[model samples]
Target: MRATTIHAPFDMRVEEVPEPVVQFPTDAVVRVLRSCICGSDLWAYRGEAARQPGQRIGHEFLGVVEETGSDVTTVQRGDLVVAPFMWSDGVCDYCRDGLTTSCEHGGFWGTVGSDGGQGEAVRVPFADGTLVQLPREAASDDRLLSALLTLSDVLGTGHHAALGAGVRPGATVAVVGDGAVGLCAVLAAKRLGAERIIALGRHQVRTDIARRFGATDVVAARGDEAVAAVRELTRGQGAHAVVEAVGTEQSMRTAIGVTRDGGAVGFVGVPHGSGTGVDLGVMFDRNIALRGGVAPVRSYIPELLPDVLDGTIDPSPVFDMTVDLNGVPDGYKAMDERVALKVLVTNG
Candidate 1:
């Protein structure tokens, strides 16, 4: 089997690696059909996020179950499933409360002994809890593949951001950044019934998708200008809710600044610079609420899967470029250079 490994910044390679096999009774061996590069993956590729040398990378994937452990009765062998970026046991207290990302027995992919998603196959622990089965019809529909893939991470993360920001029907919402997550946030806001969505982005290609995703306005400005643009769109009052999808100090400040006094900001971007430290006095004076973290993707997958299957929303456009397993490095380069909104790596 071949898998992607990051040796250092700007160095991603697909080399022959050991195939995954179930070591625990709760595990399931899945043959990955599709995987992709995430925006957060760039943090390590750019040297901003700490990553171990030769660490296996990638987390977004959907596949067919090749084998199942004895304990995995909920999902059987040959089931088509989407594995959330993080694995979790479904019975924990946190999982019961819909916060599976904080589950007591949960873990992320690519950790020391775990298999990453960017490979021919993965041994998914807690398979019954972590893998969501899809209708068998999904396997032959190429158009649905990308949308189904987004449910593993990006779409769910965007939904988390919108939910964190308290976006509601008839409310005005602003999304910071135009990355895949940001564009999906626009879709999430719309699905939640937001009356108006303002997207802050400069790229024409992404902004176009943002509009297709339901962004009512696109602010191509930056810094203070961007803030003013969002405010102007909101009739000088700022948005009722803001989704900060880019993890940067400047984007955070913009999200906070463009939100009304009593509004909330849901930040889902993988923070990249100096942490997400904000001035206490500023937040105190404005009474603004801040919420969001690694999204509980498992919790949201069930909620969003139906929509994807029913064609209520199509997020497949996010994957502007597609590559084979061996083309993983070029996929990373396209994303890092902003030449592609998102890249999908297919093994079929």
Candidate 2:
């Protein structure tokens, strides 16, 4: 089998590797059908995430189950499944409370948990707890692919951001960054009944896509001016909810500054550097509440899957490029350079 491996910063290659096998009673092996590059993957690709040489790169994917261990009951061979970025033991206390990301037995897929999905096949730990069974026929629905693939990460994270931000009917929400997560935040906010969704972006194409995803207003501003633009759009009152999707100090500040006093701020960007350290003083004075972390993607998948299957949301538009496994190096490069919103890689 061939997989994408990172030897060092800015160094990525495709090489032959041993195939994975079920190692635990709850584990299952999946034959990769589709996978995509995530924003967080860039940190490892850039050598900032403490990954070793030849580490596998990728976390989000949809695939068919090839085999399952004795204890795996929710899924079986031939099932098309999507899983959270993290694998969790469903019996953990946190998993019971819908905070599976914090499950005591939970671990991340690419960073600290299971083998990543950016190859021919992967071994999924806690298969019954982590994987969501999608309608077997959805693989070919382009409109639903966007939303279904999101059940694995971005769309769920975006929805988590909106929930943390307390978006409600008739409320106005502001989203910082125009990436897939941010655009999906706009979509989530709208789906949650927000009357106005303001998306901040610099690229015309991204802004256009944001609109299609439910952004009622687009601000092409940068720096503090972007904050001012969001504020001005709200007649100096600022939006009721603000979601920070860019894992940077600047975007975090933009999210905080453009929100109204007592507003809610949800942050989902994997903190890149010292990007989002909070200012206690401002938060205290403004009476704002901050919430959000890695999304409990597994917890949300059950409710979100029906929406994807029923055509209520089409999240797959985020995947701007698709390539065979051989083109994964270019996929990473394209995502890192902002030439593509998301890159989908197919093993079969």
Candidate 3:
């Protein structure tokens, strides 16, 4: 088997690697069909996240089940599945509370305790709890791939942001970032009945997708200018709901500052330590609500999968760059340079 490995910043390689095999009673082996690159993956690729040499990359995948552990009766061989980015034990306390992302036994994929989806095949732990079995009818459906794949992360996280932000019918919502997750937030806000969806992106392609998904306004400004634009659009009152999809101090501040007093802000960005210095006093004075962290993808997959299967949403456009497993380096570069919104890597 061959997989994408990051040796250092700007030094990524696709190399031959050992195939994964089921190692635990609760494990399942999946032959990855479509795996895509994530923005978070760039942290390691740039040496900002300190990834070990030869570490497998990617956390989002939709694939076929090749094998399952002895105790895995919920899913069987040949079934198409979507594995949540966060592996969890379904019965854990936090999982029961719909916070599977923080499950007592939760483990993130593609890192120290796990392997990512950037290879021919990968082993998923807690198969029954972590892998969501798609209906057979949806297995061969071409349109389901993008939306189904999103259940592993972006879509679910977007939904979490929307829900946490308390997006409502006729509400004005602003989203920071035009990445897959941000576009999905726009889509989520639309689904939640938000009347005005404001998306911030300088790229025409991304802005177009955000519009197609549901954004009613697009702000091409960055930093303070973007925040000011959001406020102006809302009659200087700011948006009723704001979602921070980019994990940066600028984006986070924009999200908070552009939201109306007493409104809510949902942040799903993989905070790289920049979220710690927020002005809690301002948040308190304005009566603003701040919520959101790692997306509890496992808990939301079931609800969102049906919408994907039925064509209620189309997230596939996010995959603007599709390449073979061997093109991993380009995939990483395309995203880091903002040349691609999302890169889809195929194993076959």
Candidate 4:
């Protein structure tokens, strides 16, 4: 089988790799039908995130079960399913509290000794607890399959950010960043019944998707200018709730700046570089609440699945480019260069 591997910064290659096979009672083997590139993947592509030579990449996938371990009961061979980016045991104390990302036994894919999602197949651990069952017929339903794929990561992450920020009916919301996750945050805020959504981004293509996803205002600026734009849009009071989808010091500051005095900020961006961009005194003075971390998408799947299946929300537009297993290297380039909002990798 062939999978994507990173050799160095700006170097991604699809090469033949050993195929995956179940090795534990909790394991399942899945033949991947769809997987996509994540913005976080760019960290490794740029060498910002270290990797061993030939390390596998990607964390989102929807597939069909080819085989399951003896202990796996929730799904079996021939079931169509979606695997969350992180595999968890489902019955842990933290998992029980809806914080599966902190599950003691869980781990992320594409890490050392784990199979990558951007491949022909994957060896899924904790199979019954990690893979969510989808209708077998979904294999032939491209539209639904694409939308369902987002449940593995971006959509769920956005939902987590919205929930963290305490999004509620009739509230004013602002989202920092126009990445796929940011656009989905607008969608999630709408799903949570926000009356107004302000999206901060400079790219028209992505902001257009933000609007389609539910953004009522677009601020195509950055830094203080963006903070001013959002404040102006919110009648100089700032948003009642804000989702910080871009993981950067400035974006974090912008999120905090544009949040109302008593509002909350839900941050989901993968933090890198120095400082968290937080000031304790500033937060104390405003009584602002800050929450959110690596989204526990495995826990969010069930809550968001029903809406995706029913078409109440659609996040597929985030995938503006599609590539096959062979075109993955180029896919990264497209995203890193800002030519595509997101890339979808497919295998028929």
Candidate 5:
């Protein structure tokens, strides 16, 4: 079998590696059919996030059950499924409370000695709690499969951001960043009935997707200029809610600046570079609330799945580029160079 490995910055290879097997009674082996590179993967590719040489990398995947351990009963051979970025034991208190990411036994893929989602197959721990079944027929529908793939991460994550930001019917919402997650945040806000959505981004291609996803306004500026544009658009009142989808200190500040005095900000950007340390003084004086961290996507998937199946939301557009296992190195290059919005990795 062949899987993606990182040897250094901008170097990913699809080389022969050991195939996974059912290692625990709660485990299952999935024959991967679809997987994609996440924006966060770039942290490793850019050398910003420390990763051991030859560490397996990738976190979102959809596949069919090839085998399952004795304790795994919710799925069987031939069933199509999607795995969240993290695997968690379903019976934990946090899992019951919709915080699966914090489950007592939860763990992320691509860690030391773990198989990643970007390969021919994966060893899924806590299969029942981490894998969500999708219709078997979807395997043949390329576009639908692509849309369903987002359920494994981005769509659920975007929904998490909107929920944290307190999006409600008729509320004015602003999203910072125009990457795939940010654009999906705009879509989530629309699904929640936000009347006005302001998307901040400088990329025409991504901002264009933001419009299609439900952004009513696009601010193509940064710093004070971007803040002023959003404020002016809201008549100096700012947005009722702001979502920080970029995990930069400046982006967080902009999210706060674009929010109404009494509003809230939901941030989902992976924090790097001391990006999201909020100012207590500003939050206290403005009566603003801040909430958001790594999204527990497994908790949100059940609610968002039906919508994707029913065509209520089509997030497939976020995947502007597609590559096979052999092209993964180029895929990382495309994303790093901003030549692709998001790269979808497909297998048969």
Candidate 6:
């Protein structure tokens, strides 16, 4: 099978790799039908996140179950399923509490001996806990496939941001960042009943999608200007809640600054650069709450799957470009150059 491997920064290639097989009783071998590059995947591609030479990369994917281990009963052969970015055992205490990302036995794909999602197939551990089964008929629908694919990561992470920020009916919520995750956060806020969704993004392409996703206001400003814009929209007060989707110091500061005192900020960006650290004094003085991490996507998949299948929320617009497995390097470049919001890779 051919898979994506990162030899170094800006160097991605497709190489022939051995196919995966069920290695654990709780594992299942999925024939990847669709996969995509994630914004976070850029961290390693840019050398921000250390990467081993020839390391397998990618994590968002949905597929058909080709085989299941003896202990895997929840999914069977031919069932179309989606695997969360992280794999977790369903019975762990953290998983039971809806924090599966912190499960005792949870692990990410493309690490050590695990298979990455950007390939023909992958061996998914904790299959019963990590894989969400979709209607068998969904395989033939392009719209549903795109939406289901987002459930594996970006969409769920966006939903996590909204949930963490404590978005409520009639509340004014500001989303910081205009990436795919940021746009999805806007959608999640709308679904949660936020009356006003303020999106802070400079790119017109993404801001346009944010509007379609339910952003009531698009503030193309940054720093002080961005904060002021949000404040102006909120009638001199900041938003009641803020979702910080870009994990940068400036973005985090913007999120904190634009949030009303006593409000919360849900930060989901993978912290990078000077924005990696935060000033506790600032948060303390404002009485602001911060919550978010690697989203417990598995926990949210069940809740969001129905909406995706029923066409209640269409997130496919985030995928602005499509490519075959071999065109992944160009996909990365498109995103890096800001030419594409997200890239969808189909197994062809």
* Residue-by-residue lDDT tens digits, candidate 4, 17-119: 9989889999999999999999999999999999999999999999999998889999999999999999999999998998999999999999999998999
- Residue pairs with backbone overlap in model 3: none
lDDT of each: 0.91, 0.85, 0.86, 0.93, 0.92, 0.92
Candidate 5, 267-325: lDDT as tens digits: 99987675455877988999888888899999888899999999999999999999999
Model 2, global lDDT: 0.85
Better of 1 and 3 by TM-score: 1
Q: Which of the two candidates, 2 or 5, achieves a greater TM-score against the reference?
A: 5
Query: Which parts of model 6 are misplaced by more than 4 Å?
Result: 274-277
- State every prediction's TM-score relative to the real structure: 0.98, 0.96, 0.96, 0.99, 0.99, 0.98
Runs in model 5 deviating more than 4 A are 275-277
lDDT of 6 at 303: 93
**How high is the lDDT of residue 163 in model 3?**
85
Clashing pairs for model 5 are: none
Candidate 3 structure quality by residue, lDDT tens digits, 33-92: 888898888888878888877777788888899999898877888999999887887888
Candidate 1 has its poorest 10 consecutive residues by lDDT at 272-281
lDDT by residue for model 1 over 1-348, one digit each (tens)?
Answer: 889988899999888888888889999999999999999888878988777887888899999999998899889888999999999999999999999999999998887677888889999999989999999889888879889999999999999999999999999999998999999999999999999999999999999999999999999987789988888877788988899999888889899989998999999988876756465677899998999988999999988999999999999999999999999999999999999999999996
Which runs of model 3 end up more than 4 angstroms from their true locations? 273-277
- lDDT for 210 in candidate 1 is 95
Q: What are the per-model C-alpha RMSD values against the true structure?
A: 1.1, 1.5, 1.5, 0.8, 0.9, 1.0
Q: TM-score ranking from best to worst? A: 4, 5, 6, 1, 2, 3
